[model samples]
Target: MTDAIADAKRAMRAELRERRHLLSDHARETAEAGIQAQLDALIAERDVRSMSCFLSTTTEPGTRKFVTDAVARGIRVLLPVTRNDGLLDWAVATTDGDISEGLFGLPEPVGELLGPIAVNDVDLLVIPAAAVDASGMRLGWGRGFFDKTLGSMERCPPVYAVVYDSEVVDEVPREVHDQRVTGVVTPTRTLTLAPTRR
Candidate 1:
C-alpha cells in the first residue's frame, strides 16, 4: 500500500474512534438493542448454526448480550483470542465462565483454545470494524488481524463487519492486504454486497 493510503486509513480511524467514544450511554444502549433485533432476523434468515463473532469492547457497537443469547440458543460461538504473532486464535464463549482481559484491552473467552483454522468451520462471521464501504471493503483498526485471518481462508464463508449505520460510507481506503467483507451489519440494517472473486 502507498503511504498516502495508509495515512488516510490512520486518519479516518482516529476520527471515527473519537466519534465512537463520544456516543452517549443511552444512544449506545439503544443501538445495541437495535443490533440484537437485526441479529435475530439474520440468524433466522441464514439458519446460522455455528458462527464466529467478536466480543465488543466499549466504544464499539455492543455485542455482549447477543453473544450470550446466541450461546443460550445453542448456536456455537467462537470468539477470537489475539496471539503474540498478531494472528487470531478461537475460543468458545460459554454462558457461565468469567471473561479475562486479553491483548489490546479486549475481553476474551476463557475456554478451550481452538487453533486458528477453527474459524473456517463457522457458517458466518460477525466481525468488528470502524467502517465499511458500499462495495464491502472494511476499514478496521490498524492491526490487520482480521485482514490476515480472512485472507488466509481457502474458501471463506460470509463475513459481515458490524458498524454503526452512519459508518457505512461511499468508500474506505483499501490496500492489497485489506480483505473485503461479504456485507456489513448496522444497528438498523444489514447491507449485502455482490459476490466478488477476491
Candidate 2:
C-alpha cells in the first residue's frame, strides 16, 4: 500500500462512482432485465431455499428487486440493521413492504428490530460492495460494518457481493479486517465464482 497505490485506488473509486451515476436511462432497464433473469434461474434451482439470505440495498445499481422476488417465492430474506456498535444485526425482513430506512441512509425493518440471528443459519449472503476482485476480496464502503459481521460467521454461508460488471476488478486493497466474499455477481452474470472453499 504505497502512497501511489492509495492515490490510484481513490482515483479509481471516484471514477467508478461518477460513471455509475451517469448510466443511460436504458442502462438500468437493461440491467434489471438481465439481473432478474439470472437470479430467476438461480432461485428456480434447489440451493436458494436451503438457508436464509441477507439481502442488502444499493444506491443506484442496487437490486432490491431480487430480494423482494425471493421473498415472494417464500425464500427466507434476512436484512441487516446497522447498529450503534458499527456492526450488522441480521433480522428477517419478511417482505418488501416490511422495510424502511434508519437514521443513517441505510434501509432497515420498520417493525420490531427482532434479535440478531446466528450467521450459520445464513446459506447465502447477498452483500454490497464498491469493488470486488476475481479472488473474492471485496472493497466496500469503509465503514467496516460488513467486515465486522463477517468476522462472526463460523466458516459457512457463501458470501456474494453484488455489484455492476464494471465494478469487478483484478485486485482491491485487502486488510486483515476486510472480509472475502465467496463470489461476485454482476447484473448479467449470476455468479463470477470466487476461488474459495464452501
**Local distance difference test scores for all models:** 0.90, 0.69
lDDT of 2 by residue, 128-197 (tens): 7888887788887667787777776666667777778888888887767778887876788856466443
Worst 10 residues of 2 by lDDT: 50-59
70-165, model 1: which lDDT tens digit per residue?
Answer: 999999999999998989999998889678899988889888899999988788888999999989999999898999999898878888889999
Q: How many steric overlaps are in each model, in order? A: 0, 0
RMSD of 2: 2.7
Residue pairs clashing, model 2:
none
lDDT of 2: 0.69
After superposing candidate 2 on the true structure, give the runs of residues whose Cα lies further than 4 Å from its correct spot.
1-9, 50-58, 96-98, 195-198
Candidate 2, residue 88: lDDT: 68
The candidate that achieves the highest TM-score relative to the unseen native structure: 1
The runs of at least 3 residues in candidate 1 whose Cα sits more than 4 Å from the true structure, single-residue gaps closed, are 196-198
